[model samples]
Target chain A: MVPVFLAQWMKEKRSPYMVLIFISISIAAALLFGSNMDIKLKIDTFRGEGVTVEEAERWIDRLNESGAFIFSLRAEEESLADVRQGRSDMAVRLLKDDYRIIAVMESTNVELVQQHMQAVYHEEFRIMAAASHAEDELEFREAMKTYMEQPPLKLQSSTSSGSELRSYDMRLQLLFGFSLFLAMLTVGFRVNAMTAEKISGIWNRVILSPLTKTEMYLGHLTYSTLIGIVQITMVFLLAKYLFGFSLGHSFGMLAMIVVLYTMTIVAMSMLFTGILRTPEQFGAIFTSIVPIMPLISGAYMPPGTITNDVLLFIGQFLPLQHALDALIGVSIYEQGWTDIYLPLAKLLLMAVIFFGVGINLVERRRL
Target chain B: MLETVELSKSFKGKTVVDGVSLYLDQGESVGLLGPNGAGKSTTISMISSLLAPTHGDVLLRGKSVIKHPQDIRRVLGVVPQEIALYEELSAYENLQFFGRIYKLKKTALESKIQEVLEIVGLRERQKELIKTFSGGMKRRINIAAALLHNPQIVIMDEPTVGIDPQSRNHILDTVRYLNLEKGTTVLYTSHYMEEVEQLCKRMYIMDHGKVIASGTKEELGRILSSEDTILLQLDAYDDAFIEEIRSLDPVRQVERTDQGLKLIIAKQSRVLSSIVQSAERHSVQLINMHVHTPSLEDVFLHLTGRTLRD
Candidate 1:
């Protein structure tokens, strides 16, 4: 078994394929992070009736500090033309009481721009209203100071219940999803070659030794799982450092989920290998499933985002989907182990059962 | 010591191995010879415990290996016909992996790999990937991988098939050394009668899933003891000249030779005069001639009425 493990490890170390996988994922994550970072939350603007350019810039400046919007003042005609040309990401219409946020589509940016605009302007009008009701000169001065200190619209307020620090960071979720997808294909292909080796009589040589069935099976499994874990770690780390994808502050919890998820897919790859005898079958059957697994596993759309019930239902049962859920739950939502253990347990159960059956079938078939 | 008792195997209702019982003593090199599809590999497979016998049992040293296979598995080494190796790995690495699987310690494993690499003559390029090596090089590495464990009994199944003459002889010499100097029990299987004839004291000639004959080279040769072949080298070959020589009295069979005719005749029969007279009558000039002893090929021909290769 040690020979089997060492042999596999040595082969992987000697080959360029793992490096290729890293480079491929790094390129992919780079594209994901780079493109996502370039999104223009900045709205092209104009002075509206009764609203000065100074006031518009003031609101835009406050929203920029919130890391929500980037506003640039333009001529009214030029701003409208930019909006039509899709150059301007959003527009704001300042009215007497409320401000209206506009975009071609109601995207996350649109919602955030609206929230930040409301927060900023809500304070400005509050101070104006306070100045109209001051009792004396000293009182008027005091009122203005009080109104300046207190923001009418509180973006963050103390909730009766605790605020769970959540990460709706799309870039971070793509990091998880893309890494998991590539990991599945990478390890699956490697395991398929291993199955081929088993049938090619090289595996029989090891079997001819004094090793038992369990030891041999475990060796291959452990090696592939270790490979999967390493790949995931590298991809996530690259995303964090190179592309600014954060792990939502729960690095330890995300690490645990990554470990469990790696084991699950490694077992799944073995099961996939055991079901077929040849690479052609893997290419025809298993690889056909590869693209779809990510789709259903939230590698493309993170959990609770897919609109179709049937697709979401399929994702609900997939081990990867639960893994994404658990990953997002702990790292993003600051959910404790108690909150995420069910998903973790499900992933573990899937690993044990799937790997056990896969190992048995492969041993029986080889013998 | 290893022994098989009426071992048989069938696949999909087709019997690839019939009931065959054979044995190898502690230090003897025994050969199992047959043509293609003669079940030689199947029988070897069963004996080495790679495939379970459909019937009967294999015993190592007196205990049934099927009942206590761990004892036999520990000391058994098999050299499969095909080059079973990790093409992506180097020769030293391949040997190291096999040695550790056999549970050799770090120091012993390193030394065994070095020693076996030397035995197969691949020690110079032991670090090169097997895929970069030639076919003959891979074959040598394959043999080297099997010898690292230093097993008591080694079973080689056509280890020299499709190799260059140089590598072929190297492998043959290595097997001889492992058997003679090391006293390792060897169960050698091949269709090449010359290899078996040179290396084995006793042999089993299998044909069509059964052991058709089993005996020493001399003992098997006795099947054709009544006759001997007369070789006549002529200045040139002729068909009708050999035919006329065939009709000569006491010349039982006539076969064309590269330069002349070969006559098979009974011992003590005076056929030299008829063969010489026939060559003179045909205006054929005899270059040289000699009488030769029977070989394993002749024995196979006498018993099966077909050449061992055929």
Candidate 2:
């Protein structure tokens, strides 16, 4: 096994460009797509006939409090022109007591902004109504501040494990998504070397050696898995230290997840190698199919965004989706081993099944 | 010593190797001769334990290796027809890897690598990548890789298929040295009859997935010992004259050649005289006439009705 693995390493060392290129692409892609996730969406806000500039400014502050969408007060003509000229996706028209969303197209961002505005306005209106019942304005303000500080009805959200659900970071999702997606390519191509070796007769030469079949497979798979882990680690390290992306404090959990995910991916690649006849066919088909996995698994978007039943059901079978779930559970959610054991177990199970079936197919083809 | 007992293999109910039984004695160089698809590669594969025969057993020193292939794999070195070395790796690196897989000690492996390289005459170019080497050089390295472990038996399957004459001679010399000097039993397979004739003491001639004949070169030639091939160089011979030669009482077979006609007839027969008279009567010029001795090729043709390359 060591010799076989060393042989693979020696081959790669002689021509290290492909592996280096994959790592570079992973990091570059994460830097390109992940950088945008941190910036807040900017929406232009303008005053209506009865709304003063001060009131509109106050409304903008209220809307911006969520830190998700930034609402800026602008001249009515400027805001309307920006939307008309396609400079902005949407604009806000603030009235004295209500707000209107003016836009060229409808999108999730527009709907989310509207919902936030409604919630803010409704809370303010309720506070105003409560103040009207007070004897003096000063007294009303003081009592209202106290009540707001200690609200009577507080809604708390927590997971089934009784842990508070942490805020999800879209940047980390994109970072991990693109990194793991590209890592799959690295590991897959490495695994696909099996077929290439077979075609080149190197595989038969190795078989004729005293090495056992199990050792040969283990050697190849272990090397592939290691290459994948290295690619992922390099991308993550670059993202963390170079780009200043926070991967949470759970370094051990992250490492464990990386190993499991890499192994599962290697096994999955073996299954693909078994299905495809030649290295060329495997490269073409595998490359065409891998890029779609992240999309189906909702790796590009925030969780719960892809509501299609079919896509969701299919995503359930993909190792990437489960891996992302475990990774997010560890990094973003800061969940413990108890919380992530299911996804981790699922990954292990997938590795076993895929490796078993894949090796069988390969051996059958050999016969 | 090793032998296969009625070895056969079938793919999807289509038998590719049928009832192939052969043996190799210790320190003896034997040849398995056949054309493409004659089951030579398959037979070698089965004997090397690379493939499991559908029916039969391979015995290595009186033990069946079919169930325990490790027994044979330890002592067998197979130089596949294809150049199986990693093109991206140097020849030395390829040899090193193969040697390590055979569980050779570090120091021993290093020396063995150099020894094999020296044997194949690629010691100086060992550091060059296999892809950079020419076809013959790659082939020499291919043979060098299989020799690193110094197995008792070496199975070379058409190791000189497409190479320069110089490399071909180098490989033939290497095989001869391995068999004669090192006492390594060899099962050399090739369609090139002359290569087999030059190297192998005993040979198996296979056609249509079966051994058509197996014996020493001279012994196999005896199958046609009673027959002689008559070559007639003619100048515009007519079909009637060919029919006349074919009708001779001693003639067994007559085939038209580009030069003229070839006839298989009884040895010491008077057919050549009869043919000359017939040619004169037909006003055809018999430019030359010669009686050829039967070779192993003739035996193969007599038995299979085709040449070795066909």
**Quick one: best lDDT, which candidate?**
2
lDDT of 1 by residue, A264-313 (tens): 88888888877887777876887788778767776655346668888877
Q: Relative to the true structure, how large is the alpha-carbon lDDT of every model?
A: 0.79, 0.89
Candidate 2 wrongly placed segments (more than 4 Å): A40-105, A113-167, B226-291
**Residues A1-367, candidate 2, lDDT per residue (tens digit)?**
9999999999889888877887777777767777787778999888888888778787787777775788888888988998999999899888879988998999888888888888989987887897888789678888777987899899999855577777777888888898889889989999999999898888888888878889999999999999889889988888889988889888999999999999999999999998989999999999999999999999999789899999999998899999999988888877899999999999999999999999889988962
- Per-model clash counts, in order, read 1, 0
Give the poorly placed runs of model 1, Cα more than 4 Å off: A16-20, A23-27, A30-34, A37-167, A283-285, A302-305, B225-295, B298-310
Each model's Cα RMSD = 7.1, 4.8
